[model samples]
Target: MRDFLTKKITDIQPSGIRKFFDIVSEQPDAISLGVGEPDFDTPSHMTQEGVRSIQEGRTFYTANAGLIELREKISDYLLFRNKVNYDPKTEIVVTVGGSEAIDIALRTFVDPGDEVIIPQPSFVCYEPITQIVGGTPVTIDLKAENQFMLTPEELEGVLTEKSKILILSYPNNPTGGTMDREALIKIADVVKKHDLLVITDEIYAELVYDEPFTSIAELPGMRERTIVINGFSKGFAMTGWRLGFMAGPEMFMEQLLKLHQYTIMAAPTASQYAALAGLKNNWQETVEPMRLSYEERRNYLHHALEKMGLTCYKAKGAFYLFPQISQFGLSSEEFALRLLDEEKLAVVPGSAFGKSGEGFIRLSYAYSIYELKEAIQRLERFVTRLK
Candidate 1:
């Protein structure tokens, strides 16, 4: 018998985050801050709308591009929030999730040997996806001195004739760093100079703290070249709904929709209706309140970590805190495992994000304030023991 498998798929490393999560799950006494998922339930209105859609027999497949009304709502939401206009009919394709939008975007643009410049420590998906698509993932190490935000110098340093796409994930996962408008303006200038296409993942946009979120797409001359990926998962707490969308120039979207049509056909119809309710009605009531709670938790955890003598960068968006853990003289994975064993508290090793994250550990603030306090106490005890 001959074994049959694509070497590309087999050669890729499994997700480091999930491996730790699996270990923590078997410990019944453990409290996990490992996953990046929002702890809140999907808001009631959105769930009710999903129920209504099912009751009304909306379980059938929508158009390959998704429900027109939902796409229109997404367009309006982006225009009002990000100040970028995309035609619902031609410029947007509803995806299974922002994850799928990412997959399709890479597939639509990257060819074998094309270089996709990815900044790290950031999300884990970009590199593997680029590899699967036969694209070389060129990683730029994001420094803590810069708050993990990608700099123009870093971008320029990684640029080569083969460089085709620059992947920007801000309100970034793992680090929780965000790029302000001025920072984006500098980045946009570099991107424009190099004529590089960009895939900006703004899934965490609504959860930003301290400052208003700005989309790179909103920068002048950027709307036509950037693909903005956003969804109901992070902001609306609808992760289980598995719905997201990509907005960009029609030239790209036209090709993207073809891949979506053949590969996925359409996003789930009921989920589309649920997302519509979220965009249209739940933004003010449900989304804002959840954001406020996350902000409060972020504040509490930041102060707590600092008091424990860890060097923590203040995160302006997303629900994570990446605290430098090198002072303990243990690798991130070793520290996390020991803490879990001694304290029954779980956190993701920062190295899961990238090699540059080796000296850090990412703690999510998506849990309740009470849970956060307990976790912090355990963390302090763990650090004291090391001291």
Candidate 2:
């Protein structure tokens, strides 16, 4: 069995975020701050929309590109929010999830041996997915000093003749970083010069707290070269719905939809309706409150970590906190393991995201304030012992 396994697949490690939670399942009483999932339920109206779709016998397949109505909704959404226009009929492919968009986008644009420049520590899937798609994953280690936003200088340093695609994941996972509009323009100029395509992961676009979220696609010369990936999972709390979409130039989107049709056929029927309802409904009625809650949680968690004398980088975009634990003289994995073992609290080792994540651990503040308070007390107890 081992001999028959594909060497490429075998080389990839299981998700680091899930590792501690497996221990958490045994601990029973253990509090897990590991998973990036939102603690909120999908808004009731959206759930009812899914239920309605099924009750109305709409359990069939959608169009290969997704329900046209949903695509229009997504189209209006990008145009309104980001000022980037995409033709709903030609440039959108509804996917199983943002994960699938990531996969298909790579399939559409990346050829074997193409170099994909990625920034770390980022979401866990990018490197493995790049490898799986037969592309070389060229990673740029992002620093806390830079707030993890990729600089033009850093991006320029990694470019080569083989560099075909660059992935920009702002409202970055694991680190919670966001790239401001000013910074994105500089990055865009470099990308234009190099003629590289970009896959910008904007799944957390609506949840940004610091300033208005900026999409690279909005920058001049970037929309044509960029694929925008977004979904209901993060902003609409629709992880289980598993609905996402990618928008790009008609040329690229045509290829993405072709691959999606063969690989996934279509996203689930009811999930599309559910996502449509999410976009159709008032943002203030549902997602805004959730974003505000996340912002509050972000502040509280940052304060708690600071009060513990830990070096916590205040990330303004996503829900996770990457608090440095290097002062305790332990690897990020070692710190996370001991904290889970003795404190019965679960968090992810930063190295799971990438090697650049060493000396830090990721804690998702998407949990309740009550859960956060309890976790902090346990963390304080753990930290006191280290001292």
Candidate 3:
């Protein structure tokens, strides 16, 4: 059995976030701030639409690219909101989630031994997926001083003749760092100079707090070279629906669609229609309110963490706060385990994200204000004891 397994699959470590989550599940009184999932239920209108689709017997598989109407809605949404235009007909492929879109994008462009530049303390999937595809994962450690935003110098520092793709996860997971238009433009110039393509994960785009979200694809010369991955999970609280899409130039999308056609066939049909309803009707009524709630929660958690003497970069998007825990003289894993043991509070160790995250921990604020407040109280007590 050991001989039969591919080293590539076997060598990859299991998700560190899930390992802690499973442990927390067994402790009945534990409060978990580890998982990055939205606490809100999928909007009522979207769920109702899914139920109606089934009630009306619309359960058959959609076309390989997905339901044309859904893609068209996605196209319209991107154009109207992000100012980037992608043709629904040829440039978009619906996926099993933004995760699948990421895998496919790497497969589409990267050849064996090609280099994929990944910034650290990002969502955990990118590096392992790059390895499974036989692409070398070149990690850049984003600094706390830079607010964890990847600078143009950082991008240029890792470029090589073998570099094929750069994975950009802004409104970043764990850190919640976002790049403004000017920052993106500078990075775009570097990408163009190096002739490298980009896979920009914008799953958290709609949740931005300080400023409007800007896509790299919206930057000059970027639309043709960047693949945008977004989905219903983060923005619409539809994680269980497992629905997302990737949009890019037709040339790359054609290859991506081929892989998706063979591997995925199409995204779930009911989910597609439900997502259409979300895009078409729920943005103002459902999505906006949820975003506002997250914003409020973020403010509370940021202030609370700072008051407790945890130095955290103020996150601009996403629901996470990555705070430096080095001053306590404990590894992130040690601090996290002790926090869980002493306070029955759970958070992800920063090292779980990457080496760059070693001195920190990621706390999610996607829970209710009541839960966050209670967690903060526990954390305060825990920190005082350590001091």
The whole-model lDDT of each prediction reads 0.93, 0.91, 0.92
On the 0 to 100 scale, the lDDT of residue 338 in model 3 is 95
Residue pairs of candidate 3 with colliding backbone atoms: none
Q: Record all residue pairs in model 2 with backbone atoms less than 3 Å apart, i.e. clashing.
A: none
Model 1: per-residue Cα lDDT over 118-194, one tens digit each? 99998899999999999999999999899988889999998999999999999999899999999999999999999
RMSD of 1: 1.0
Residue-by-residue lDDT tens digits, candidate 2, 1-387 = 799999889998888877756767888888889878899999999999999999999999989999999999999999987898899999998999999999888877888999999999999899998998799999999999988889999999999999999999989998999999999999999999999999999999988887999999999988888999998899899898898999999988888888998999999999999888887856547888999999999999999999999988898887999999989999999999899999999999999899999999999999999999999999999999999
**Over 4 Å off, model 1:** none
In model 2, the runs with Cα more than 4 Å from the true position are none
| Superposition TM-score, candidate 1 onto the true structure | 0.98
All candidates: TM-score: 0.98, 0.98, 0.98
Which candidate, 2 or 3, has the higher lDDT? 3
